[model samples]
Target: MGVGVFGRNHARVYQELERQGEAVRLVGVVDSDLDRADAVAREFGCRAFGSIEQMLTTHSEVRAASVAAPTVHHLEVARALMQKGVDVLIEKPLAASLAEADELVQLAATHKRIAQAGHLERFNPAVRATIPLLTQPMFFEVHRLSVFTPRSLDVDVVLDLMIHDLDIVLSFANSPVKEVRAVGLPILSGKVDIANVRLEFESGCVANFTASRVSTERVRKLRFFQPQQYVSVDYGRQEVLVFTVGGDGATSGAPTVNPQIKVAKPTVTSEEPLHAELKSFLQAVRQRSTPVVPLEDGRRSLALALDIVAAIREHGKKVGLAGLAKAKS
Candidate 1:
């Protein structure tokens, strides 16, 4: 609803879908800043409003909306929409806290509204391709790095970046986290700019994640090891490379580095993840079916991200990071 950076993208995708003759229409865009909302509305040929109240009142026909407002405002915005019988696709880090997330769950249940979580990576072709290859992931190494940006400074790297990988790993592992250890530092913003986390799941799966907003080059990759297979997923490139041991390597069309090892690239249909996610949300709203990435999944990921943040803070205290920063200053 709020036409900020991510919100603008959501608006654009909705407009594109409308152009493609999707059964949906781009009714309007909303933002706290009226000027920004007006600009986006003009660009997308829709109406604009300064607040959810104004938008909902003006567009009572609005059946569904995307809540791309600030993380702290998610519950408020989604609550208003859901109460009005509007389904919602809420962005990641679903709510500011667990209590708010729980309330969102309850509200959706009470209203019988279709709610989806905006975990964009789940719609990535690479991630989709890796799903079938999942056997029993024992270890994982994930990296999501980007050039520094002032956007999303309201949260630390754990929430801003690492949460994507967290959601993916959590879904892949399908197990409760047994332990978490993390360390992070604020390089350019008051919030954490870089973080490294180790998560051990109840299924004996260990995952190491490194997420940074301050990096020289961008990298988004996840590599995991299963029983006799290793899979690599490139989020940006939308590619999946699977290496299996003791296979014929005949069907893969990829050269075998070793005689016993086989490499196969799963076929992935390239499509904008936002487009796919929105399409899925709309389908769920139409058929009264559960969304692929539901609000419960968002809450689960948010819980883990919050836990990692807490672990990082504890580690900082143990290592006297405050003293080190003071000395350097």
Candidate 2:
């Protein structure tokens, strides 16, 4: 219901889906800034409203919506929609805090609403392609970097970027987190702009994550090791590469430098992740089924992200970063 950068993209995709005859319509766009909302609605040929209440009052037929509002207003916006019998696809990080996330889960249950978490990576073709290759993932090295932008500065790097990988790894490991160690620093904003985290799962799996919003180059890649396979997923390129050990190289047919290693690039059907995510959300709303990425999974990721943020704060206090910065300033 927000017409900001991410919300605008949602609106555009909805319009695209309608053009492609998806049995959906872009009824309207909402934003605190009326000008922004008006612009987006004009571009998508829909109505514009200044508030969720205004839009809901004007259009009672909006059975489902994408809540791209700021993290802080997630509960407020989603509550208004859900209470009115509208399904929702809430953007990532779910809510600003764990309490809010829990409340969202409860609200969905109480209202019997079809709700989905907006973890775009879960819909990425590369990630989907890598799902079948999962087998005792023991270690992971993931990186998500982007050039500095003023957008999404309201939250730390953990929520802004790392949470995506957190969701993925949490699903892959399928075990409780045993330990969390994290360090972060504010580079371009008051909130953390870069962070590195180490997580150990109860299943004896470990994952290292580095996320930065300030970078010279953009990179979105995840590499992991399983029992006999190492899989690499490039989110930006929408590709999956698998390397199997001591297996006949029948998948790729390309001669490997090591005869013992066989490489296979899984076929990934290219589609905009947002397109797939929204389509799934609509299907869930229509059939009253569980969304692929549900509120529970979102809450799980948010819980871990909050723990990492707390760890980062603890490390900063231990190293006297606050005092050092005060002295420098």
RMSD of each: 3.9, 3.9
Global lDDT scores for all candidate models: 0.91, 0.91
lDDT of 2: 0.91
In model 2, the runs with Cα more than 4 Å from the true position are 247-259, 323-329
Candidate 1 lDDT score at position 48: 93
**Model 1 lDDT per residue over 52-103, tens place:** 7898788888999999999999999999999999999999989999999999
Task: Report the CA-based lDDT of candidate 1 relative to the real structure.
Answer: 0.91
Backbone clashes in candidate 2 total 0
Q: Candidate 2, residue 93: CA error in Å?
A: 1.1
Q: Write the per-residue lDDT of candidate 2 for residues 1-329, one digit (tens) a residue.
A: 99898999999999999999998989999999999999999998999999888988899888999999889999999999999999999999999989999999999999999999999999999999988889899999999999998988878899989999999999989999999999888887878888899999999999999999999999999999986778999999999999878745534666556658778998899999999999999899889999999999999999999899888888887897663233110
